[model samples]
Every structure is written in C-alpha cells, then in structure tokens.
Target: MIAAGEVIERPASVVKELVENALDAGATEISVEIRGGGVEQIRVADNGYGIPHDEVELAFQRFATSKLSDASDLDAIPTLGFRGEALPSIASVARLSVVTRHADDDSGTRLEITEGRIVDRQRQGASPGTAMTVRQLFRNVPARRKFLRTTATETSHIQNMVTRYALAYPEVRFALDTGNSSLLTPGSGSLREAIAAIHGLNVAENMLDISVVDERSGQSTVGGVISQPALSRANRGYMSFFVNRRWVQSRMLGYALEQAYHGFLKERRYPLAVVNITIDYDQVDVNVHPSKTEVRFRSGDRVFSAIQQAVRQTLTAHSPVPEIRRAGATHPAYSPASRQPSRYFWPIEPFQPSPAPNAERTGELIPNEQDAASPTSNGDGGFTHKETLPVLRVLGQVQSTYIAAEGPDGMYLIDQHAAHERVLFEQIKADAATSAPQSQSLLEPLTIELNPRQQELAHAHQHLFSSLGLLIEPFGGDVYILRGVPSILVEVDPVRAFIDMLDEMAQGGDVESWSDRAAYSLACHAAIRAGKVLTHGEMTALTRQLEQCQQPHTCPHGRPTIIHLSGSLLEREFGRR
Candidate 1:
C-alpha cells in the first residue's frame, strides 16, 4: 500500500494511468467522471478490447502485462503501459473495481480489489468494453491524503490532462464530467473542429494552418494550427505536441518551435500551437517515464534541427511585406504643405530683409514652436527625439496584419492591434488606480443580454467596470443596461465591447486581482487595428513617445516593441567596402 501511495499520488494520477490504458487498448472513445476532485470516486469507461474472464485476475498483478512477451520487446515500446504497475499499484491503495468482457464471451467478469488483495469476483452480463472505478484513494495513507489540494485544483489538473489527449487524438471522442454541473465534450471529428469544441471558437478562428514535409527523411511530417503573432500569450501552456499519435513532452521540440519563430514574435511572447509530428517509430523511445509523458529520440538534435528548419522555411515563405501609405495631395484641408529640397548656388542672393525687427527675428533669429518641438539632429545627422511617455509609432502595415516602425533608438514592430491595446491598457490601469473613472454619458442607454455564467461574472466585476469608466447595471434577468462609457471609447459600440470583454474574461479564467491579465486583453480588443494609415509626423511623434517608456523595447504584454540593428550591421549585410 505504501509503495502504491508513492506511485499514485492523487486522483489525477489515477485518471492519467487509466486513460493511457484505454488509448493503448485502441479505444476510439473515452469518458471520465470524478467526484470530490477524484478523491472520493473516479470512473473511466472506454470502448476497447476487453480482458478475458481467465485473464481478469492476472490483470491486477504487478509487473504483469500482455504488451510484452520478453525483455527483447522493450526495445520497441509503442504502448502507453507496459510495466503493468498502474492497475496493481492503484488497487493496492484504493478500492478498485473492474468490469470487462472479451469479444468471444457472452458474459463478463467483475473484479474488486482493496488493500493489495482481491476482495471479490463475480460473473455478470456486461457490454463489450471496460469500465474501471476507483474509490477511497489513499484512504489507508492518511498522510498522503492530507497533501491533496482542494477539489477545484485537482479538477483543473484533470481537465488539463484530458485536454492534452483530446488535442493528440482528434479522431477519438472524449467526455469529462467533474461531478459539478461542468462538463466538457469533444466529439470525434476534424482536428480544427475538435479544437474549436475543446478551446473556444475564437482560438480556432485565429489559428493559421502550418504544414512541412521533408523529402529526404520519409520520417518527416509536421502539421498544426499556429496562432497569429497578434494573438500571442505570455506563457507556452497552450502549446500542445503529439508525436505519432502519442502525447509526449520534449524540450527539444519546444526549442525548435521557438527557433522557427526567431524573428517573428516579440520577447517573452509565446505562440499558441498544436503540432503533430510523424516520424519513424523505431527512432523514438516512449518508455522513459513512469507516467509515459516524456519521450527520447535517437539523434534528438538532428530531428530538432530538421523540424526547426522546415517550420522556419514555411513561415519565411508566407511572410508578407508591409505596404507604405502615401499621403494624398488632393486633401488640401488636411494635408501639410510639401517642401522641395533646398538647392545651393554660387553667390546666393543676399538674404531678403524684413520690414521690421520682429519679422526678422521670426524668420532667422527666432525658432518657431514647430521647429522647437522637433528632435535635434545628432552628429550622424539622424534625428534623436525623446519623450516622457510610452509611444506607439505607426509603421507600415504588412498584408494588413503587422505594423513596423522605428522608435527612439531601436526599430519597432507591432501588431497594430496589440500596440493600441497597450495604450488602452495604460489608460485603463490609470483610471483603475484612481477613483472611479469619469464616464461619458450616452444619450440612449444600450441593453445587452448575457448567458447565466457571463451574468454571474459581470455582476461580480461590476466595481472593476465602474473604475474603467463603464456605467452598467442589471436590467433584470440576464440583461444589463450600459448608461455610459469611457470618453476614449465614445465612438465604440458599448454593448458589443461589454459582451466581448465578458467572453474574453471568462475564457481567460478567474481574474479577481488588480493585476489580472484580462484587463490587458480587454484593452487590446478596444485598440486600433492594423492597416490604419498615419502621416510621417504622426509616426515620428509615436517614436518619441515610445522612447519615454521605461521598458521601451517591450509593450505591457511582454511583446517587444522594437528590434535594434546597428548601422554597422546593415553595412556588413551589404558587404559595404
């Protein structure tokens, strides 16, 4: 029992093993149910080949498995379980029950084991599948049971585990019930459809399809959906990887993904991706960990390099060049006067004299406000502007997707929408820190309907919205009235923004603290999008503003706002002589 306690720490661990067993059995569908965070009870049902009545008793013996015949079979371990410790170990520490039937048998056997002993066995009519139940986990080991976390925490871990398998095997249907009313059902279908069902629909919509095939290795095929740069996150938790239908964690694979995005993403920002790699099974080892979550590849470096190169090539080929927005000369009312380059001639005519001293002072002796506001030219003849606040320079838009610009001392590239989000984030944060935000009253109050869950979150965060200059109140049922909004968002549709914010926040998880990330996401959604044109002066002003920021290189969300390349580096690139 003690040995089992060490191996099967908690209910989530039990779920992991059982689910793996189902996968190894070639199950096309799996369902899991847990009560009290899986501590009180756990049930795993799968439509897979079941054990024979004769073999039912042997299935709970330690070190016994049908996956291998001898030691030689260890060289190629393709299944999720081979040591056969899962069932026996779990049975030793908990009340374990198994109901299974073989295809040839008309009836099945039910076996119950407790405290490392088979308590009972009976023959019963059952379906052609397997259903395992575990109860009172770690009951004998009170010390270990005490270490278990809250029900919510344990349930979250189970949810994450289920999500991984759902991503790895889109062809397999999966269902999970957490004893609470919460349920997750990802029906069998296409990878995209599965992803949409598991994650939210917005994530699926933003995913970019990426595929790479290597001709030399017949072992190479990488395909997945990657999030656009604008939709990046602060962590890599959302990224999922599967190799040959098996989910395994490989640091090398993660590094390869980062390398592939070398010049594309900003620092500290990770791409959301779900990639599946197909390689020769013989070249991989899936028996490295007891949990079977880690993998080892023969010549891992070689595989890593190949995957990185393939993804890099694909991204480079698809990268689009930004378009330059030219200023229109027809809009005389809004356009600045164009000036021609000054020409120098021998014995230039004497400078024209002014009728009054004041006129002469303004023309030559005095500096105008416009000239004073402009940055001073440095010794290298480059303008060196500085500012006191963070600024976002308007760079040209590429494929109407990305924005590029030059900041105070570095080159700035922004997802136009992301940049605007940073600006809006600052504004919201400032308002939040002070008293309630100053709301701009709307002539007509806007009403919005929300789901039960959304309404709950909205009511809970009413104070937070009030601080962000939003005036909202319950209008009975799952509807709310928006009587006002932040002055900056006067032009925006208040009802739509409110609903979208609620959805984004819910998807992002609980956010009760002041430093919650949902605030940043909300700001981003309200910010400007890519492809918006700006004048040269506006771009220059943005550069000066960005220079004033403490961390000028990165925005609030940890995405780099600038990339610096020295003048000397540019010369070297061109082989300047």
Candidate 2:
C-alpha cells in the first residue's frame, strides 16, 4: 500500500502504467475498458509480446524488470518501464489478474492475485499478448479508496491520459470505453488525423505543422503541430509535450510555447499545440520523478531554443487571416478564441470632436489632415510567404466598419480599426527605434493626478513615454504635467491616453515590456475608431498600408485585422457547388 501510493494515485495512474508497459512491449493495438470510473473494474488488452508461462508467477515480484540488466543501464534508460514496480505495487492494493502467452510458448498462463497473494494459477489457451484486469482498486486501503473523486471526474482523467498517448504515438491504434462513451483513434500514422480525432476536424484544419532538426549535432530534433492564433483556448490544458515518445510535464516547454506567442495571444489565453522533442536517450534523464513524467535535459538551453524557434517560425510563416463565418455557421468545437471580442465599445459620432472646417470628408472619426495621411513603414515589409495572396482591389466599405475588397483567389474583409492599429503599432516601434516620434506642444499643458502606484510607473517608464511623443514631468505629490503628446493624438484627448498607458503598464502581464505595452495603448488610442465613413481614396490607402505591415493578420491586441472568404467557400454558400 505504501509503494502503490507513489505509482497509483487513482484509476488514471493504473491505466497510465499499464499503457506504458504495453508500449514498451511493442503493442500496435491497445484497448481499455472501465466501469465505475475504473474502480469497480479496469481492463487493458494489448497484442504485445507477453510473459512466458514459467515466468508469469515471478512477474509480480518487486524490482523484477526486463528493461535493464545492470545499474549502469540507468544512465541511458530507453524503455518506459525500468524499475518493474508497477505490477507489484498495483497487486498489493487491488485484485489483479493476468493471462498471457509468450511468443515462444505453445500454451498460456493465467494468474489471479488478490492483495499480493496468488489465488489461482493455471494453463490456458490464449493469444500472444497480455491482458490485465484490475478490480476493486484500493479495496485493501480504505483510506485511499475514500479519497478518490467522483466516477465522472476519474473517467475524464483516464480519457485525457489515453488521448495524450494516442497523440504521442499516432501509429498505434488506441481505444477507451467507459461503458457509457468511448474514443477510438485510427492509428493512421498522421498527426493531423490524430488531432482531428481528439480535438475535432475544425481545429485540426487550423493547426500548423512544425519540424526542426539540429543537423550540426545530429542528435536533437523537434516536430509537432501548433494551432493558429485564431484557434486558441482559454487555458494551457491543450498544450502537450513529449520527449522520446514519453509524455512528460515540463514547465520549460510551456514557457517556451507562451513566449513564442508573446504578442499573438490575448490575456490569459493559450495556444493549442502538440510538440514532441526527440533526442538521444543519454541526453535526457527520465528517472527524476517516480511517475517518469518529468525529464532533465543535458542541454536544457539547446532544447529550449529549438522548441521556441520551431514554434515561432511555424507561427510567423503559416498564420493566416481569420475567416468570417456567416450566422448559424458551426463554430469550431475546440476553439473559444475564434469568437472576436465585442466591438460596441468603439464610440461613434457621439464621442467625436467637431471636424475642422477644411477637413476632407474622408469617413474618419476626426476628418482632419492628420487622419488623412497614409501610414508609413521603415523597412521593406512584405514577407516571403510560400503562397502569397494577390494584391487586393478595394471594393467599398461595409456597415461603415469593414472594408470589403476582392483578390484573385477570394474576397477579403478588413477591419479598418484593427488594420490601422497594426499599421500604427509597427510605425510607432519603428520611429522609436530611429528617433523620437513627432510631438506637438500643447497650447497649455494638461495636469493630471495619479495614485502612488501609477506615479511610480510613470517615473520608471518615462523613456517609453518620450518615445511615443508623450512628454510628462512630475509636478508635485501624485500629480504630473503633460507638456505635449504625439502628433497623431493632437485632436484626441491626451490626458485620457496618458492614463490609459499607466493602467496598461500597471495591470498588463510582465511578459511584455513597458515599451510594448505603451506602444500598444498609444496605437489603439490614435487609430481611427470604427463606424466612421471613409472616402474611396482613404479606403484604398488604408488597405495598401495594411499590406505593408509585417504582421498584417492581427492587431497588437491579437485581434484579427482581416477575414478572407475563399472562392470555394463562397460557392458552397451560394449553392453553386
């Protein structure tokens, strides 16, 4: 009972250990059945090489393992089960029975052990594999049994474990039946297909493939699939990492994944990914933990760099503009991030100041000369994409918000506010790099009051403020004077924009630097608000500038800037195909 505490926590632990043993035995097909959340009955059947009839009795002995012959083999443990503690530990806590026939044996052996004592041993006709049934788990340890959760929760845990293993070994057919519902994977040897089976087809379609190999070392390689920025989840539960085909819990892997999506995911949102890292057995130590889910890498830095780079490169290269779905369309079952945030917050004419007398009638919130100028970039900005969309031809504006246009392959709808924000954010960062942004002194400086925390943030981020053309000075206790603001925000309220910056810096997660946080807020404040009518030339200019942005797909806030409606999709919607 004491040993089982470390290896068998609940029904899920038993399933995990048995599955790992089957995998080590080279099983190509595995099936698992459970009742009462695997506490009443649990069965795992596999077609792997089984134990010989003569040795079947000795298999339950503690520390008896075929994976390693000597202590030196511990340094380079290759198989998933090496200590051989699973059988004995589990037998001591539950009623266990095993029927198996080794490949070289003409007959099979059956053993029924209850509470670590054999009750039945007989010869039987059986296939060349192993079938283990654990019944009345933790029956001998009433304390442990009392601590188990409800049956439904335990079933979810077991199902999750099985799905993860199926992802790691796509070539192995896996099935789990809880006597209520079941899951099956085809073992098609395709990662994408496996993902579709587990997460649904819609999510699988949006996943991007990533593969990176260190040819110089010829020992480490990383490969997997990552969700597009549009297909994220609310938690990191979707991220899975495997080392040498063994599922492991790794904080470094999680951090690397989040870092790769720094500005590409919303607050508290995490990407969905299945990343597998393959390296030499000697390069990683899997015995760090009793469960074997934690690994220590010999070259932790190299592994981190490889994972981060692979995910980053895949995202930058393959991320596409989100598609706009019609009403009543089926939303992806796996994605909560696809639903855009509410847009009603962008105030309309009620919030705009009076237009200048000679301002052009360009459908902008502030019909001023500043809003009419086209956005600019400092470097050659178009990416060398594998499949580039043709230059868009501006059609017209939709609902005074979305810019409807056409391309060679499909139609495009661009969010004017989001597109402009993307453009201005890049420009702000670029200008900050070269020189301070253009600033205009106010006729009379505006004074504002801040709390102690905000005041501290202001003093610490003055350089970032100056870069965005926001010049501030401490006037007195908890008070500051804003001398000038960015040229783009001359017409907007400088005081509100300044306060917004402080709030962002104070509340924003520490992943982004103060400068990025400042630029993000500044761009959002200065960008043209939605619901403004734009002249044809203004619309043309907006889309053209958007195309020059390095990351034209999303705004700084990770909202989609454009939605593409492919020609084939349009045809299907129109009943033409």
Candidate 3:
C-alpha cells in the first residue's frame, strides 16, 4: 500500500502508468475504458508484444523487469517504465487481472491477483497482445479514496492525460471510453491531423508549424505547432510539452513559448501549442520523480533558446494580422490575402454600445462639475487642456480608437486603451497608498460557481482578494458570493471580472506581492477598450486625466500610450520646408 501511494495518486495516475507501459511494449493500437471515474473499473488493452505463459505471474512481482539489467544501464534508460514497480504497486491496492500471449507462444495465460496475493493462473486463448484490468481501486486504503475530487473533475484529468500522450505519439491509434464520453485519434502520423482531431478543424487550420535544430551540436531538435495570435484561450492549460517523446511539465519550455508571443497576445490570454524537444537520452535525467512527468536537462539553456527561436521564426513567417469576429458575421472584416500595404486602413464602424440609463459615470477623467466648464472654447467642444501636459487642442478622434490632437510642434495620436490603462493604474496606486483601495457596492450581489481547483485557490488567497476590495464570501460548496468590487471595475461584468481576477491570482507565482498582481488585473479590466466610441466631452476629460498621471508615456504593461509625429517630419514629407 505504501508503494502504491507513490505511483498512483489518483485515477489519472493509474491511466498514465498503464498507457506508458503499453507504449513501451511497442503498441500500435491502445484502448482505455473506465467506469465510476476510474475508481470502480479501469481496463487497458494494447496490441503489443505480451509476456509468455511462464512470465505472466512473474510480471506481477516487485522489482522484476525486462527493460534494465545493471546499474550502468541507468545512464541511458530508453524505455518509459524501468523501475518495474508499476504492475506490483497497482496490484497491491486493487483486484487485478491480466491476459497475455507472447509472439512466440501459441496460446495465452490468464492471471488474477487480489490485494497483492496471486489467486488464479491458467492457460487461455488470446491474441498476441496484453490486456490488464483493475477493479475497486484503493479499496484497501479508504484514506486515499477520500482525497479524490468529484467524478467530473477526475474524468477531466484522465481525458487530458490521454490527449497529451496522443499528441506525443501521432502514429499510435488511441481510443478512450468513459461510458459517458469518448475520444479517438487516428494513427495517421500527421501532427496536423492529430490536432484537428483533438481540437476542432478551424483551430487546426490556424496553427503554424515550427521546427529548429541546435546548430551547436545538432543533437537537440525542437518541433511543434503553435496557434496564431487570433486563436487564443483564456488560460495556459492548452499547452502540452514532451521531452524525448515523454510528456512532461516544464517551466522553462512554457516560459520560452510565452516569450515568443510577448507582444502578439494580450495579457491573460495564452496560445495553444504542442511542443516536443528531442534530445539524446543521456542529456536528460528521467528518474527524478516517481511519476516521471519532470526531467532535468544538462543543457537547458540551449534547449530554451532553441524553442523560443523556433516559435518566433514560425510566427514571423506565417502569422496573419488579428481579425475581429462578430456575432452572425459571415467573414472577418479584413482578408490577409487581399490586404496590401498602404498609408491608410480599410474603414470599419467602431463598436459602440448604448450607455446605461441613469448610471453614475465611473472611470471617466476629470470631475463632473469641471467637465461642464471648458478651459478653451474649441470648435469641437469646450476642451479642458492641462498645463503639465503639452498645450494641445482636441481636433477629433480617428478610428474611434486614437485621440487626435494638435500640439505646439506637430500632431499627436493617443491610443485610448493604453492611455486609460495608465491613468487607472496611477489612480489605483494612489488610492492604495492611503488606505485599503476604494470599493463600490453592487445593487445585487452575484454568486460565482468555481471548479475544485479554483475553489481551493480562492480559499487560500482570501486575504489577497479582500485587500483588493473584492469582498468574496463562501456561499456553499465550490461557490463564492461577491458583494462589492474595486471602484474601477464597476462598469465591467462582475462575474467575468471576478473570475479573471481569480485566474490571475492563481498564476501569481512570479509576482512579488499579491496586491500588485490584483491591482494590475483590475486596472487592465477597467480600462477603456480600443473600439469604444467616446463623445467630445469624454475624450476631453480622458486627455485631461492622462496629462496629470505620474507616468503618462507608457501603460502599466509597458505599451506606448501616445505617439508624437514631429512637425519637421511632416513638413519634409510634403516638401514644405
């Protein structure tokens, strides 16, 4: 039982071990069927070279293996299962049965074990393969059984496990049946086909292929498919990485992939990718953990640089400009193939939603009283220009996204979203400097349902949430109630804003403090979007507030808030000098 704890932490762990064993046996076709969230039953059948009749019972013994022989062999271990503990450890906790026939044998053998004791062994008719069945898993250990999550969550973990292995080995046919759901991947040996099978065809079409080899040694190679900037998910769960054909969770690889899309993707959005790095067996150590999901590389820096460069190269070569997809819209507003470089872009109506009725204006620049009184009587409106900023006259808005103004020397174009983000960030910092940031109460509280993992994270980081003016209280199992939010996020949807904040908090491992992360997330969410239409008064107020910010040149995320076109440059272009 103690040994089983190390190899089988949950139902997914059992599936991983069994499938890995099947792959090691050179299985071309594998099938996995489970019931009762894999706790009541799990059957793994593989068309691989099975054991002989005499070795059927020996395969159940601890530390008995055909993969490795001596201590020296550990240096270059090639097979996935080398310790020989998976079969015995699993049998020790469940009722297990196995039927197999070696390629040389005419018939097969059947063996049964209950709680680590062999009970039955006999001859049976079977094909040249192996089929293992486990029932009532962890029945002997009630303590471990109680630690499992809900059935849905457990099933999700198992499905993710299967999909990951299917990506690593595209030539192997794999099928999974959970009695309620099913997934199958053809052994077509095409990564694109595999991606289309798992994710939809539309997503597969947008993925870009990438391959790069280490020029220094030519021993390490990185290859995979990464999604275009237009296709993105809200989280990083879609990324799957493998080392030497073994699925592993690596921080360095993930970081490299993310860095490649640094400016292309917005904050909190991640691209889907399947990255595989093939290297010499001796260069990596796979014996670091019992699960073998992590490895140590001797030349991690070289591998990291290789992955980053490969992804960047692919994106630069095949990436298309991002397009906006609207409801009931048959096609994107712009087509890449028909696009041509020009001084002006195709005009499209900016997105403008009706303002709420009788809603108190929040996140607007300048006070309500000062908004009515204009400092300068411009033809457009009573413009409120500040002294600290460049003396400018509000000319008009361009593309409903940039605020065009006339400066003393030339013209200035300001990105509305970036400028708002800068203003909100400074305001939040100032509020937090004095007290526990400001919060506004909602007319009606909202209840949010979270998954098991999210619930655990919310509970663990309750203090951080409260510090950011989000008053979240436990409503019931896997549910939280929101009574108020940071003042800046009042106009945003309470549910989405809260959930996005929680997701940001979950990925705060690299952040120095939880407060700073929460603050940044709120500011980004509360800032004005790019396509929003602003009235003359609103634009004037926004520009006024931006002028007073401590750091108005760049947003909190380091994006330029404004662009300056010098008068000399414009004159030279027109030959007016």
**Which numbered prediction scores highest in TM-score against the true structure?**
2
lDDT of each: 0.66, 0.80, 0.76
- Taking all chains together, the TM-score of candidate 2 against the true structure is 0.82
Which has the greatest lDDT? 2
| Model 3 residue pairs with clashes | none
> On residues 1-577, what C-alpha lDDT tens digit does candidate 2 reach at each position?
1122368889999999999999998998999999999999999999999998878878899878888888888889889888878898889999999999898999889999999999999999999999999999999999999999999999999998999999999999999899999889998899988888888888888888898978888654999999888788898899999998899999998988898886677768999999999988999998887788999999998898899899888776666666656567775321123322222211211111222322212113322344333232224532221122235667999999999987654688899999888777877787788775777889999999999889988898787788778889999988899998887686689999989988988876553467887888888998888998898867766765665566777888888788778676788889998
The residue-by-residue lDDT of candidate 3 on 342-379, one tens digit each, is 21121211111112112112566533333333234445
Tens digits of per-residue lDDT for model 1, 1-577: 1122235877888998898888888788899999999999999999888898999999988887998888777777667677878898899889999999887889999999998899899999998889999999998889999999999999988888888888777778888899774545455557777778777676676566777667786544787777655456789888888877677777878878875674456767788888887777678877666666788888787777666766665554332212122245221110011211122211221111111233111111121334323444456642232221113334565555455553232233555454445545655665578765657889998998889988887888888888777788999987888898776565567677777777767764224333344456556556655566654443343333333322333345555454433333445556972
CA shift of 194, model 2, Å: 1.6
RMSD (CA, Å), each prediction? 20.2, 7.4, 15.3
All candidates' TM-scores?
0.57, 0.82, 0.61
In candidate 1, the residue pairs with backbone N, CA or C atoms under 3 Å apart (3 or more residues apart, or in different chains) clash, namely 391-545, 391-546, 395-404
Error of 1 at 547 (Å): 26
Task: Give me the displacement of residue 442 in model 2, in angstroms.
Answer: 5.6
